[model samples]
Target: MSPIFMTLLLIVTLGVFAYTANRRWRLLMVGAADKRSDRVGDRVRATIEYAFAQKRMRRYPLAGIAHQVIFLGFLVLAIRSLILFSRGYVEDSSLILFAPHTVIGDVYSLLKDVFVVLVMLGTLVFFYYRLVVKLARMTLSTEGAIILGIIFVMMVADVVYDGAWINLRARAAGAEVTFSGWEPVGSVLALLFQDAGDGVLRCLAHVGFWTHTSLVLVFLNLLPRSKHFHVITAVPNVFLQNLTPRGRIAPIEDIEGKVEREETLGIKRIDQFSWKSILDFYTCTECGRCSDHCPATNTGKKLSPKHLTIDLRNFLYQHETALINPSRDRKGADAENAEYAKDLVDGVIDPEVLWACTSCRACETECPVFITYVDKIVDMRRYLVQERGEFPNELQTAFRSLETSMNPWGFSQDERGQWADGLNVPLISEKPDAEILFWVGCAPSFDERAKITTRATAQLLQRAGVEFAILGPEEQCTGDFARRAGNEFLFQTLAEANCGVLNGYNVKKIITTCPHCFNTLAHEYPDFGGNFEVIHHTEFLARLVREGKLVPKNRVERTIAFHDSCYLGRYNDVYDAPRDVLRAIPGVKLVEPEQTRDRGLCCGAGGAQMFKEEEPGDERVNHMRTEQLLATKPDAIASACPFCIRMLSDGLGDKERTDVEPLDVADVLLRSVEENVPAEQTAGA
Candidate 1:
């Protein structure tokens, strides 16, 4: 074959592949703008700092190093391949001609060979870690494994072909090229090829080269059709990811004050998801990052966020043709279109998996591709709760209670202020013009264990001379639990009622000790015209201490570990404020568990899981969290969320570990101040 002809053919082949791949990519990414607005500069900075730089990955040293090396090696090898192809066949030119075999080309070729070996080894290690060693519970479907294996084979074949070709060409020209200076493994192969007959060596070179090229082409074509589509979708998903409040639910607006009777509130089918969500499904690498971190999954519940995405993707692909041609009848279609409505309900997801999530956002936090698993799960919940009216028995009763009493526990709305009978708490209705409206959440107003936190917070506010008033009996449930449980209608009812009452009072700033209340009031209420500045009690206390309004004199000489609540820490990014409040007390040493900040494990209390019983599992989520906290062996375990406080306290009580007390962040702050500082100083400071 003529060298010039071969060069042109290769160029044409590459151009065809690139064009097809890019066209499909453009189509899939068409409506991404409506789902999420792009901030190019911020994304570029994050990509370089967090993704490519592996800043997040580096926290896990061994795995991080392995991944970083493989990623960087792929880039190096890609450039080397382009250089080799251009010099060997296409545009046959070399810088070495100026100096007649300069050392640079040889050095570049050697380094390329070395990196190829490194990449192959790294991939092999990952394969064993995922499959053989089973260090983690990795998802290895047949399709996924086949795609990975083909990519690995291509890497090996490319290096072998290059080495073999170099040896054959040198032999054909009757030049004695030393193999000793070449890369370790490739040098040995080159030496072996030197003694082979020219005819046999040339044939082997062609076979190796063709095999490498063919595999690359096959991989390219299969990418969009396989789970490996993440290779293309992952980067774009990361770039266009939601940067808004993670704790907040997306608002569903009433179109012209006319609710569409047939319209779905959350995702009922795959098509109903925002295009970004569809991209999220395609971009999941099935790395099990979410599964590993999920409280439900870790505790042996059926909900694996990674598997949820996989199932949704599989269902979409299975019905792709029918979905693309809606007018045409298919095997599963009913003559009267009866089966069309039942397709998603029966096909895409199991009822158990859909209901098992705690809406903890732990999955989304751990996912390297930035998949929004919580949003998708919540959407599915909305379908089941709003449209189908299907839910756990406990949740159904809770919904009824919320409808009647404006609380989930069936307590009388008039008696909601019973917990504050002896305490000096003011009602916002009476003191409607108060500076701060204390939104005492459902649990604290009712639950016995949580009431103490509320009273302490109120007393602390009074001591700080901060004028605050409560909604009293007029306050309704924030409906966070209902919304997270998938009752969008109920959520909207509760949100609108609460927004109306607050608006009537002209409330400007609100404060709450409950993380759930803080999240709902700060994030979701704005959707219903409740635009108050909301602060969690820990954040408020931290600020108070910083301003010298609250002073701590005594040092509690005990190791205290702070548990990051899912809503407060992962959902709202309020990890530091609670810790700051605790650390401000002299002699209080703060110890941290292994999972903190972005990777914090859930207490399994959010998503209305607190109201419903946990599914049968080897370990309870609270027990797992308690064990982690116990490992720190602190004198006390502190938390900001009432649900977390209750769960952890019960877990410890069950374990009969009375020595390690579970205290609300406010209680701990109060105790530390009570012991260290004189009452006069604490009151007047």
Candidate 2:
């Protein structure tokens, strides 16, 4: 009767689980193609480290530790769950090699008991977090609470079942057994049922056994329907993470073929999202870590990365049948006007939410499972900009400026060399023999504040006796802003044009003061067949300092907080080079912001935010970042990116603290280098 009953239950539970899983798999298959299976070894290693090891969770120590315990407990308990299931069919529940009373079984039983307690404690910690301490970073959902309750009950049920079995066995033998192999928790619990009647003992054992087995099935079915579905999808999601440099948005291939194929230039509908993106939506744990660290969300913007994933995931499910069953649609015109005909941007996600993103990758960095947020946001932006011609009006001026002059500021290309006028900077045309092409990015070329950084970098390069030439009148914006702002066509045009010019020059290597330009030229331009060695000015300067070609002399003493530009640090993993440059200088006490390096906040200038008016928010992103640097009370702030310098300077101005100067790493190094230079050499020729 027991074997028959358990088999029927198992079949029913497994059938439901398979049905739900198949539905999600079909939904995933409906998405556009994305190659996530390349590099098998790397994917497996990433899965082990990120998914199994829970590497990212360690950022929050207590929560991380608690999760580790719970995770391990689940893995360990899975075997025990199997054993318990088998006990319903067979007399003995232990594995074939390790039966009750054996050394292996005894050791396994002991470990299982220890973990059972630890798992309960782990759940208790979360209960305190949710119900008592109430951490704001965690999403408080009844679903989450109920899941917790279910886990707690599962543990209790397992304990009760074990204890009741022990009690019944001892009673049947008419003896008091001491320290049995599988009875650590059971022994302790058995004492309570020892004096109970035979009928009561049997009832307790039956109830406990049924509850534990039934709840396992309940939890299995709960996945794919709740945020907890991460347990099923997270490992696969982490394995499939984009392996390219984080900043490299895949270029649109065959941009001109859209008219003939009736294909939208960018993602216009849910079906256009990549399979990996759909996996990302399904894998989200709803931990709220992404939104917690997101500058946009923290400062009152409508973009919460967590909620964005949730919204998209919900929409994916809401139209799952509509998306997966295209064949079921009516014939003729109704086929074209399918069930999921509603627009996604304004229909599902608000425009305010879309434009508020800074593309900082903070959310991606914080996500434990490596789910990307920027790619999705940018893809949708591409749709709005290219297909619908519906985006923020401020972007129009930027697009117009970029279209006509190849710079967002509408500055004449003739003035690109003006910053280095006194220094007699060589143009690539005039000095085609130069080794390095100094790519003076748009801000450095046009923005007043950034021009100083450009000049400082130029002076340092000259002082170091390195032969570098600028593009001068031929230089164009790298189209970083346009691309990030969703104007991919403009970016592609600019990239191809710049590649042609660079190829004409036969340039081998390039250096830039802007992280944006460096990232674009180094990572994104390669897609346009413009592959060339590119380095950030900070890194080049750091290398020069290390090689003893450029020495920082004289104590231009000041405490400076080094701001990590998102493009340089997170996008390209170039964090230490800029700091190493600052550290090379004598009498420069380098301080770090509360938010620094991979965890650094954005300056409201990235994602083309500098080119457009900031979305409505309580506090500006740059000002918030400036405040973090200001909290250190440094003499000045030092940054590598020209954009960062401008944003931080503007932030300091807004706060009326001009005394806290914003200086580039190059500027600080230049101050020390020039102090020892001959006054005549520094002066005009």
Candidate 3:
């Protein structure tokens, strides 16, 4: 090895990499500041689980296994690369501890050879995916193939260098090249060249050494310029992932101040996004796992989470010089750098793409690097709704209805407690000292079909001797729908009013049948000073049954397929409670749909889609989810969320599957709990 040439190679390649990385860093800083440095312990644990352990990648078995091997191989072979670099300066350098004859070195040599072979096999797996099988879910570009080729060649070159070096050493000692247990792969390779001359062997060693080392440096520089940038940013991205409750959307702070200051309401321009979001763009692996699982994408909607991130990232990189310029941040830069000031909604991303999202979090769930979609989509929608007054005509109506009547449907707030009229349910105003307040959501209070679930839940609580009271007319919409639909002003007004009411009553605990209400109250309300213990009815019922407070004695003979609400299952991780309630009923067999629990398909009702028509798609999301549940061949489809019940009921009707019933868990539980009661006396009946 030539020290002068190697030193020159190191200086030039390392210098180029440093410059490229610094440019990326500067671009990242161009976005607004974010707080990701807090909670060091939690960040470390997540980095270990999702990054080092490669937890989320394992969701797709073959690809996960292949990636794990390649990732671990890179880590193990990192030392080998460093050792190779050091040997350029000191020909016999093993850094003392890894000298060939020592036990520590022997073990490492064996591990290194094993991973070299494993790494090659791993590359072949991806080769099959990219070339042979030609998976549509991944970015099968020539660059991907080239990177894989570099890795494969790097492994081969390393083996060649080891084999030639072993042979050269034996020849120098005038001894035969004998196989050593510590160097199994290299020993085996050396046998192939044992018959070659010393000059040829030296030539082979030089070629192998130079090719491997040079290609390693080249690969290092290629990373920042390609999607392989994830190779550098993925771990940090995971470490800095949003650690707040998954269900809670970060609210816009100081809304009036921002409005008065004429600051952008939401993400009008790409630079308005926080740096963590910019990192999200950079760290996207383009693996399409997010899109594959996304309800909007699967249903042939305009939004593909992968492509959305990619489009923004491309726009960022396309205007990197202007965006990173300090002049761009100064006044009047908008006129000078008009391209950089372009609205992200219709310029970089189609408005329809943002509108189609269900906010089900499927994309976020499937993302191996923890890139988020809902927040970004909602932020863009905020710009559309608040800043530009350009949202779907339907959302405008919903917003007005919410503003006037405190519900999306414009139902009179005075009748909010009518659903519990005959169930002996008391209002919190009448019994202000009640232990828990039932937060009857808009759907349950106003929609006729959803009222049945509301009644059933109330009757069950009464039968269990749980002293719970309702908010009655004092309750307002939780603003989950408004916030998600990008009406931040309306959402904040509703949230503040609702919080004031609840706080006035000194409400400590709440029970709600709507997953949306439960989620907003428990996770989102704390941000507005409305902290309370919110429990979904199914969870409360499950606990009552567990504590021997509510016994299900009557036999409700039915095979039920429980449909998971995305808010309940994916957002809040409340999968088991509903299932537990269903299982407790005698003669009721609980079955599961293929896409149940966290992977459950959206009912197409979240993100305020319930109040508006779904964006055009190949199929309605709820219809697709209904077909999945129907595949289980259940006597009934049971769910806990009022919105889910309503959408699924419509799904059943649309499919003309009237023979199958769509009942809420409370509806089914009421049938069993009210033993020997007349059928018409039951809440559902």
The per-prediction CA RMSD against the true structure, in angstroms, equals: 4.8, 2.7, 1.5
RMSD of 1: 4.8
Ranking by lDDT: 3, 2, 1
lDDT of 1 by residue, 414-452 (tens): 888887777688888778779999999999899887887
Local error of candidate 2 at residue 672 (angstroms): 0.8
Arranged by TM-score, best first:
3, 2, 1
What's the true lDDT of residue 182 in model 1?
47
Candidate 2 lDDT score relative to the true structure: 0.86
lDDT of 3 at 438: 90
Q: How many clashes (backbone atoms < 3 Å, residues ≥3 apart in a chain or on different chains) does model 2 have?
A: 0
lDDT of 3 at 173: 82
Give one clash count per candidate, in the order shown.
1, 0, 0
Name the candidate that leads on TM-score: 3
| Candidate 1, pairs of clashing residues | 554-676
> For model 3, how does the per-residue alpha-carbon lDDT over 1-685 read when each residue is reduced to its tens digit?
8899999999999999999899899999988888888899999999999998999988888889899999999998889999888888887788778888899899999999999999999999999999999988899899999999999999999999999999998888898988888889999889888998889998988989999999999999999999999989999999999999999989999999999998888899888999999999999888998998899999999999999999999999998887776665535535535787788888889898998998999889889999999999999999999989998898888888888999888889888888877678888889999999999999999988888888888888999999989888888899999999999889999999999999999999999999999999999999999999999999999999999888998998899999989999899999999999999999999999898788888888998888777888899999999999999999889999888888998999999998788889988888888877554443321
Can you tell me which runs of candidate 2 are displaced by over 4 Å? 167-176, 180-183, 190-199, 330-332, 676-685
lDDT of each: 0.76, 0.86, 0.90
What's the true lDDT of residue 183 in model 2? 57
